[model samples]
Target chain A: MSIFKETRITRLLIISAIILIPIALSGCVSGGSMTATSWPGVTADESNLYIAFNQSVFAINQDNGKVLWRFPVEPEKNQTFFAPPVLTEEGELIVGSYNNNVYKLSASDGHVIWNFTGAKDRIIGGSVITDQIVLSPSTDNHLYALDLASGNLIWSFEANEALWAAPMVDQERVFLSSLDHFIYALDLATGKELWRQDLENAMVDTPVLAGDLLLVGTFGNELISLNANTGDLEWRFKTEGWVWSSPAVYDNNAYFGDMAGNFYIIDVASGQQIERAQMGSPIATTPAIGDNEIFIVTEQGDLYARGLDTAHPLWQIAIEGRMLSDAVLANETLFVASLDADNLVSAMNIESGNLRWQFAPEK
Target chain B: MWDTLILDPMINALLVIYDLLGNNFGLAIIVFTVIIRLITLPLSLQQQKSSMKMQDLQKTKRWKDLEKKYKDNKKKLQEEQLKIYQEIGFNPMSGCLPTLIQFPIIIGLYQAIIRTLAVTPIQLLDLSGHIYQSGFFSIPSSLLPLTSNFLWMNLGQPERFWVTLPIVGLFGIPVLTILVVISTYYQSKLTMATTPGDGEGQGAQMTKMMSLYMPLMLGYFAYTFASGLALYFVASNLLGIAQYSLIKSSKGSNIDLAPVKKSVKK
Candidate 1:
C-alpha cells in the first residue's frame, strides 16, 4: 500500500537508466572513436594509386582499380595510416602512420625499407619527399626532415601547435601552416626557422604559392596571401564561411570553396573577389584544375565540372559518398576519394563524367 | 530539431566559456557544469520536494490503515491509493517531471564537450557546422584546436598519470578512472530509492544491482574513453553531492531510502 513500494515504476526507471547511461557514455566516446581513425588519404603516380586508409596503405593499379599490394598484408589494430603517402623519386613510398612512425617502403612490392619512430605523436599530414630529404609534419608540432634513403632524422623544427598541413617545400625554403594560427618558413636543409607570421587563426591546408604570394586558406573564414619570402601578411580576403579547401592557383586567380557552399575566384595579386557562386553544397576538398575545366567535389558528394573562366557548371554529377580529400587528376581521369562508400576511391573520365572504376580492397 | 534546439547552443556556449577562460578546457567544463546546475536548481528542488512529500505520505497512519484494509485485494489497493492521492491533491508522476526535462541537458553537455575538443579531421569538420560564426553570439575561430592538454592529461585521449616508482620503472596509472568510480558509487549510493519490505523484492534487487554496477560501468568508460568525460563525471558527482546536501540541510531531514516496516504479509 506504500506509494513508494511501486515496483513497476522503479523497475522501469532502473531499466531506463541502465539503457540510457551506456547510450550517453557511448554517445560521447563514439564521436572521437569513430573519427580518430579518419577518412582515406589518396595519392597517385603514373601507373599506381596509393591509398592510406584505416589500417593499411594499398598500392592500386591505376587503370583497373585493382589493389596491387597492401602493406603488412594483415591489418593491425594499433597501426593506422591516413596521411597521403609520399612517393619518392627513387621509387620508394614514404608514408606516415597513426602509430607515430614513418616508413619507407618499396613502391613496387610494399616492403618496408626503413622505419622512423622518433616522432612522439601521430603523423597526420603527408610528407614532402625531395631527392635527399623527406619533410614530414606531425601532430606533435614538429616538422621533421629525414634522409630520403635512410629514414634517419636529419633535423626537426617545433612549432606552437599541431602541424596538420603538408609543408610546401621549394628550392631553398619550406612553407608550413599550423593549427596554432601561424604560418612558418623553414630552411630546407636544416629545418631551421626562417620567418613566421601570426595570422590569428588556424590554417588547415597546404599553402599554395601564387606568384610571390603564398595563398593560405583558414578556419578563420579568410584566405590570406602571405609574402613567400618573409612570411608577412600581404592581404586577406574575407568569405562567408571557413575556407578549409586549399586554393588552386592558376592564371593569377585563386580558386577555392567555403563551407557555406560558395565557390570563389579571387585575384591572387590584390586579394579581391573576382567571382562567387553558390555550389549548393559545402566544398571541403581542393578543386582539380584541368586544361579547360575545373573539377570540384563537395562534402555532400556532388561533383561539378565548371569552366575555368565561369562559375557556371559545365556538368554536375552526384556521387554516392562524402568527398573529403583533394581530387587527384591523372591520365585524363579524375580520382576522388570518398567516405562511407562501397568503394574507397572512384575514378571517372575527366570529360564525360563516366565512372571508370571504383576500388575497395578485396576481403 | 535536436541539433538546433539543444546541441548547437550547448557547444557554442561551452566554446565561448573556453575562449573566455583563457583556453583552459578543464576549467571551462567545471564552469559550464556549475552554470548548468544553477540554471536547473529550481527544477531539482521541486523534484526533491515531490519525492519527500510522497515518502512522508507513505509513513502516515491513514496510509498504513488503508494498506492493511486493502491487503487482500490488489485492485482495491490501487483504487484506495488513487483516492488518497486525489484527496491529498498530489501527483505521483511529479517526481519524474524534472528528470525528464533535464535529460536533454545531460545529453547536450556530453556532446558539446566531445565536439569542442575535436581530435580528428571528421570531428573538426562536424564541429564547424554547429559553431556560431556570426554576430554577437560568435565564438572566435582562433579558439579552436582548443588546447586539449589540460594539466598532464590530453582531454581528447584516455588519461593516465605516469609515475616512476622505485624498482618499477615507469608506470601509467588510471588516476582519473579511479576517481570516477569512487564518485559515481558515492552519488548512486546517495540517490538510491528505499525498498518498502525487507529488501527482497524485484525493485530492491534492481536498486542493489544499480548501486554496484553504475560505478563499474562508468569506470570502464573512464578507462577506455577520453579523460575529459571522466573529469565531467567527477565534477558532476561532487556538485550533485553538494546539491543534495543543501536540499537535505534546508529541509531538516535526510532523503534516506531506509526501510519502512511492512504492514501486509504476502
Candidate 2:
C-alpha cells in the first residue's frame, strides 16, 4: 500500500508538470507579452507596395490590393521584419530584419540579390539608400554603410545606444539620431564623425534636413532646430508631449505631432509654431504631405486628412488596429499599415476618406 | 491597481539603484533583491515560526492519536483536528499567509525586470509612461536606453557561455540555468529537511514531490526567459537559503508565538 501511494504521487507530479510547464513559459515566447514592438512599415514605388511586418516582407500590387510575393516563401521562425524596405534607382529592394541581416532583393520579383549579416543586433530602422552606399542603423548601436551593388561593408559608425531612427542623407554627409540622446553627423565618404550634439533626451525620428536647418524631434518634448552644417542648436520649440515622429516639411513649413496628440505647424525658418491642433490620440508616425493637404495617423487607429492652410482636419476615418507607421501617399492614393494580423494593409482615396481597398492576409 | 501599487514603484526603485550603481544592471538587481528580502523579513520570520510550530505539533502524541483514530472516518478526523487546533490556539493559515502575500511581489519583480530592460519599441514606449518624468524622483531621460550588457551576458536575452572545445567544436552552455537549478534544489531540500518526520503520509509525499519538481520548473524558467530574470532566481534562491539558516541558528531567540499553545488537546 505504501509503495503504491508513492508511485501514484510521483506519477501525479509528473503529469502536473507536463501540463503546467508550457502554460507557465508561454509568456516568454517571442512576441508573446506584446504582439509586436513596432508597426508594419510600408514603402512604395510607382508599381508595388513593399511592407515589412512581423515574420515576412510582403509585396502588394499598387493598382489592386493583391499579394504579389512574400520573401523567404516560408516564414522563418527566427526572422522578424518591421523596418520599411528602401528602393534603389536600380530597382533593388534593400531591407533589414530583426535577425541582424540586411537583404538586397530584386524589385521585379522577390529574389535574393545579396545578404549582409554583419550587424550584431536587431535592425529596427530602415536603411537609407544613397548613390553609392546603403546606410542601415541597428539596435546594436552601429550605423552600417554597405556597398549598394555587392552588399559589402563600406564603413560603419558606432553610436552609444540603439539607432531606431533612419539616417538622413544629403550631399556630403549623413545625420543619425540615436537613443543615446545624441545626434551625430558623419562624412558620407568615410563614416568619420563630423559633428555631434547631445539633445538631453533620446531621439527616435530621422533628422529632417530642411534646407540649411536640420529639424529633430526628441523625447524631451521639444522640436529642435540645428544648423545643418555646424551641429549647433539653433532653436527649440517645446511641445506638450514627446515628439516621436519626424516632421513633414512642405512649402517652407514643418508639420508634426506629439505623443500627447497635439499636432503643430511650425514655420521652418523661425522655429515658431504657426498653429496647433489636437488629434485626441498619440501620433507616432510622420505625416504624409500631398498637394494641399496633410495626412496623419494616430496610435488609436484614427486616420485624418487636414488642409495645410488651416491645420484643421478635413475628414477622419477609423482603422481597425493601432496605426503607428507613416501614411504613404502615391498616385492620389494613401497607404497605411496596422498592427492587426487580419487587416494588415489598407489603401484609401487621398481626396476622400473612403476606403479604396483593404488587404487582409490568410492566416 | 497592481501597477500603481507594486510594478511602478519596483521599476523606479530598480532604475534608481541602477543609476546609483553606475549603470551596472547586474549589481542593481542584486541590490534590489536584497532590499526586498530585507523589507519582508518580518513576514518571513512569522512564516518560519509557524512552520516550526506545525512541526512541533506533528511530533506530539495527540496529533498521532488523532490521525490513527481518523484513519477510518476522514471527516470526523478533520473536525477533531480543527477542534484540537483551536484548543491549542494555532491557526493553520498562519504558515501560508506570508507566501500568499509574496505572490504579487514576485510577479512585480518579474515585470519590473522585463520593463527596465525594454529592448522593444512597444515595451520601451510603455516604460516611458511609467517613469517619473519631472519631480524629486525623476530619472534622467539620458538613461532611456539602458545598457543591458553585464559580464559577457546581455541581460535582455537568455544567457549562454560559448566555448570552443577541441573535439566537440563550439558549444553554448547555460551557466545561469544550472546555478538556478542547484540553488533551488538546495533551498527546497533544506526546507523539507526541517519538517518533523519522513513517514509515508500524504503531506510527506506532497512535500517530496514539490522538492523534486520545483527546481526543474524554475530551471526551465531560467533557461527560457531573459538572463536578468534568471539572475533574480539565483539570487533569490541563495538568499532564501541564507535567510532560513540565519533564522534556524537563532531558534533560541525570543519570539512571539501567541497563536501556538503547549497543549494540543481540548
Candidate 3:
C-alpha cells in the first residue's frame, strides 16, 4: 500500500508538471528573430516581465535576465503587431495579434487560457485587463469585452472607425479612443455606450485617468483632459506633432511625448505646461517615473533619464537601434527593449544609467 | 446558364448569411455549407445522371472493344474516349464543373476569412478597412472582432504548447487536441474524391495518406490561425457532409453515407 501511494503521488506530480510546463515556458523568447521589427510594450508582475514583439509574447524572469517562456503568434507573413501586452489584476496577460485575435494567457506560464477573434482586421491596440473583464480594441473598429477566465465574449462596442488605442478601465467604466475622431466612455459590465465625445482627429493614445479627469492625446497633436464621469473637456494642451504615446500621470503632473521628439510635463489639474524637454529624436515611447527622475526613450535610439523637477538630463545613453517600447520600472532597475537591436531587452541602472545586463535571443 | 445566373448569386447570398449570424465565424461556416448544398441541387442531379450513364457505358460490349483497341496507345485511348463521349452526346466537363466551382468558392471563403480577420497593424491596413467599420447586429461597432476560442485554441497563433491550454481537462483525460485531430481527419476523408483506374489498392493507400496529411496540415494551421477560423473550418466540414448528403438524396442516388469507397477488388 505504501508503494502504491508513492507511485500515485509521483504520477500526480508528473501530470501536474506536464500541464503547467507550457504555461511556465510561455514568456521565454526575447524577440530573437531578425525579421521581428518592433517591441512596443513591456509590462511586469511580481515574478515575470512580458514583452510583445512581432507576433510573439516573451515572459522574462524579473530577478535575473532569463527567459521563462515564449508564445509565438504565427500570423501570416504579411501581418505585423504593434500593441503592448496588458496584465490583469488576477494575473492574466492579455494581448492581441494582427491576425485579429485577442488572447488571454496565464501570466505565470504564458499558456492561453482563452482567445477572442476580431473581424478581418488587425488588433493594433494592447488589451486592457480589468478586474473582471478584458477590453480589446481592433482595426475591425470594435471594442470587445471578454470574460477573463473563460474567454467567453461578454459584449462588444462598435466605433465608426478603427480603434487603435488601448482601453483604460476604472471602476465600472471603460474609456477608449478611436481613429474615428471620438473618445468613448462605456460601461465595462455590459459594453453599453455611455457617451461619445468627438475629438475631431484620430485619437490613438490610451487615455490616462488622473483622479476624476481623463487625459487623451490625438493625431492632431492636441492633448485634452476630460471629466472621467461626464466626458466633459477640462483643458487642452497642443504640441507640434502628433501625440501617439500615452501620457504618464505622476505626482499631479501629466507627462507625454510626441512625434517631434519633445517631452512635455503638464500640470494634470490645470493643463499648464510646466516644462518641455527635447530628446533630439522622436519621443514615441512613454515616460517612466522613479523618485525624482523621469525616463524617456526616443525613436532614434536615445535614452534620457531626466530630473522631473528641474527638466534637466541626469544621464543619456544612445543604443544602436530605435527605442519603441516603453521603459519598465522594477525597484531601482529600469528595463528597455528595442526593435532596431533585434528586439533586445536591456536593463539599465536607474540612478547611474549604467548597463547592468542585456538578454538577446540565441540565433 | 446555371453557373452564371443561379450558382454565383446563391454563393454570394450564402456569404452574406455567414456575415450575419454570430459574427462568431465558425457558426457562419456551417450555414455556408448548408446553403451551398441547396444551391447545387441541379448540378448534383446532373452529376448523378452522368455517373450512372458512365457506369452503364462501362458494362457495354462496345466500350470493351474500344478499350482493347486503345490498350497499347495512350493517344488512341484518348481518341476512343472522345468518340464514346461524342456518341452519347455527353460533355465530361459538365459533371466536373460543379466540383471545380466548389473548389474556388471554398478557397475564396478561406482567403476571405484570413484576410478579413487580421489582428496586426500591417494586416489591419491590408484588409478592407471599410468592411471592418461596418456594424452588425446593432452592436454599435463593426462585426469583425469576435473571440476565437471555443475549447483550447487561440486560433491565431501557431499551435504551441506554450500558449494553448494544458493537456488535461474534465476528468483529467486531455481531450481537446484529440478532438481537433480526429475531426480534421474525418473531414478530409469526406471531402476527397476517388478517380477510376486509380487501382483499388493504390487508391486506398493514397486516400489513407491524404487523410492523414490533410488533417495534420489543417491541425497545424488551426493552431496558428485565430480559433475563429478553426471553428469555421470545423463547422464548414460538418456542414459539408450534410450538404453532400442532401445533394445525394435529392438526386436519388444510392447515398453511401461513408466517404467515397474504394473498390474491394484490386
Candidate 4:
C-alpha cells in the first residue's frame, strides 16, 4: 500500500494544507480588507471642531459632539485622512490625505473648492500655512509649497528621506525636519535651500521655535536644541526612549515625553534634564501646554494633567484608546482624539480634568 | 505571539540586510532567505537523512513481501509498517520537521515584504508602529526608500503583470518564479521516497505524482504573491538542492524518484 493511496495521513495533510496555507496567504494582503477603521485627529476653532477621520474630513459642533458636516458628502474614493483638518485664515478646511491629494473645502459647508495633486506620495504631515502658501510634507520625500488661492504648485524641495514632520514656517525661511535626519531651512518663496543641517537622528516632529532656539525631538533617543538662524546644534539631551513627541515650551522649559513614557522638562539653554516624570506606557502624543497646567497622553490612552514644574500628575484619566495626535486646546476645553474607541474625539475641561463631551462616528 | 517571535525579528533582520546591501529589498530577501536556510541546515539534514533511510527501506525486497503478506489486512499492514520503521530505526516525524519549520518563516517574510513596501498612508502608519524606535539596533530612516527593483522585477508587486523594457522584461521577467518552479521540481524529485527494482510500484507512482504536484503548488504561490516572496522561494529551493546534493555526495544515490532506475537498453 502506498502512502498517498487512500491514506488518512495524506487526507489529513491535504486538508491541513488547504486550511492553513490560505489563512497564511490572507495575511499577505492584510490592509483595507477588514472593517477596521483608522483613528481620527481633531482640531478646533471657536465654535466648531474639525476632525480628520478615516476616509472623511468632518466638522462637529464644539459644544456637543454631533458631527456637523462631512466633507466629500459622499466618499467617491477609498482615501483616508489622519492629519488634523486645519482651518485657514480664510476659514477654509484644508486637509491632506492618503490618496496623495490635498483638498480645500468650505468650512461653512463641506464642499470641495480646489484639490492639489502635486505630491508624489501620500500626505502624512498636516499642511502649514505661512504668507498665503500651504506647506505640506509628504512621504514622497518632498516638501511642497502650493498657492492656497490657486491650488497651483509654488515650489517643491526634495529631501533625501521622507518628510513626516509638518513644516514650521516663518516670514523669511521655512524650517522642516525629515526622517533622513536633516533639518532644512529653506527660502520661503523659491523653495531654495538657505541652510541644511544634519541632526544625526530622524526628526519626526516639527521644530518648535522657542525664543530663536529650535527645539526638535528625534526618533533616536535625544532632544536637540539648534540655533534657528544658522542651524547649529546648541545642545542635545539624551533620553532612554525615542523622542517622537513634539515638545511645547512654557516659561523657558521644553516639555515632552519619549517612547518609554518618560516625560521631561528640559532647560532650553542648558539642555539639562531638570525634571522627569513617568507614565505607564509610551507617550505617543505631544503634550498640550495650557496657561497653568500641561495635558499629556500616553499611547496606552492614559491622559494626565500635571504642573509645569513637578514630575507628579495633578490628575490622570484613562481614555482607554490610543492617542497619537497632539491635543488641541481651544479656550478652556482640551479636545483629545481617542483612537480605537469607535473613532472617539472627546473634549475635557482643562482646568477641572472632567469630561465635557465625547464624539464617536455613528456607525 | 507572532509579532514577538517571528514578525519583529524577521522585519529587523530584513531591514538590517537592506541597510547593509544598499537598501535593495530584493537583495535583502535573497540574503535573508539564505540565512534562514543556513540556520535550519541541521533540521533539514536530519529530515533528509530520515527520508533517505525511508527510501532505502522502500527499495528492499522485504518491504514488497510485507505488502503482499498484509494485502487484505489493512490495520495489520499499518502495524507491520510501524514494526518495520521501528526495526529500521527511522523517525517519520523527522520527515515533517523541515516543512513545519518553513511555514512560519514564509508567512512572516510575506507579511514583512508587504509591510515594508508601504505605499499608502495607512500602510506607512502601520509600518511606523513596527519599526525599531530606539536602541543600538535602531535603523536610520535614511535606510528607507526601499527599492524593490532587482534584475527584472519590482519585488513589491507581482512580476507577471508589470510592463517594462519589452524583450528584457519578457525574458528576465519573473525569472525568479520560473526558478522557483524548476527548483521545487528538482528538490521534490531528490527528496521523496522510492520503491524497489521495478518502476511499476505504487510508492514510485506516488513519488512521480508528488514531483509534478510540488512544482505546480509552489508555482501557484510564485504567480500570486509579491515577487519578493517568489525570490525567497527560489532561494530556499536552490539552497535546499545544494544541501541535498552535498549530503548525497558522501554516498552516491540515484537522483530519479522512480524505482531502481534501469540503464538505457535499446
Top candidate when judged by TM-score against the true structure:
1
CA lDDT scores, all candidates in order: 0.83, 0.83, 0.65, 0.75
The fnat scores of all predictions, in order, read: 0.53, 0.28, 0.00, 0.12
As a whole number from 0 to 100, the lDDT of residue A158 in candidate 2 is: 99
Give a tens-digit lDDT track for model 2, residues B1-266.
Answer: 98889988999999999999999999899999999989988888887877667667666666667677666876666776676567677776665567657756776787888888888887776676678777899877667677788998989888999999899999889999999999999998888766434457666667777787888988987887788988998999999999889877775423233332335333
- Kindly give the number of clashing pairs for every candidate: 0, 0, 39, 0
lDDT over C-alpha atoms for residue B157 of model 3? 35
* Ten contiguous residues minimizing lDDT sum, candidate 3 chain B: B257-266
A-chain TM-score of every model: 0.94, 0.92, 0.85, 0.92
- Residue B241 accuracy (lDDT) in model 1: 78
Candidate 4, residue A294: how far the Cα is off, in Å = 0.7
- Candidate 4 structure quality by residue, lDDT tens digits, B1-266: 99878888877788899989887888888888888888878877876775666666666666666667767876766666666556555556655666577667767877777777754433444665677756888766555546667887767556664446756764334666678899999887776532121346554555567678778877877876667778778888888888888887667333223231222111
- Candidate 3: give its CA RMSD in angstroms: 15.7
- What is the per-residue lDDT of model 1 for residues B1-266, given as tens digits with 9 covering 90 to 100? 99999889989999888888998999999899899888988888777777667666666776667677777886767776776777677777776678778877887888888888888787888889999998899888888889888889999889999999999999999999999999888877666542232356576678788888989998988898878888888888899878776765665332233232353323
**What are the clashing pairs of model 2?**
none
Report, to 2 decimal places, the DockQ of model 2.
0.28
Best by DockQ: 1
lDDT of 3 by residue, A84-177 (tens): 8888877778888766787788877778887776455677778887777778888778988888887778899999877877888888999988
Candidates 2 and 4: which is better by TM-score? 2
RMSD of each: 3.3, 4.4, 15.7, 6.1
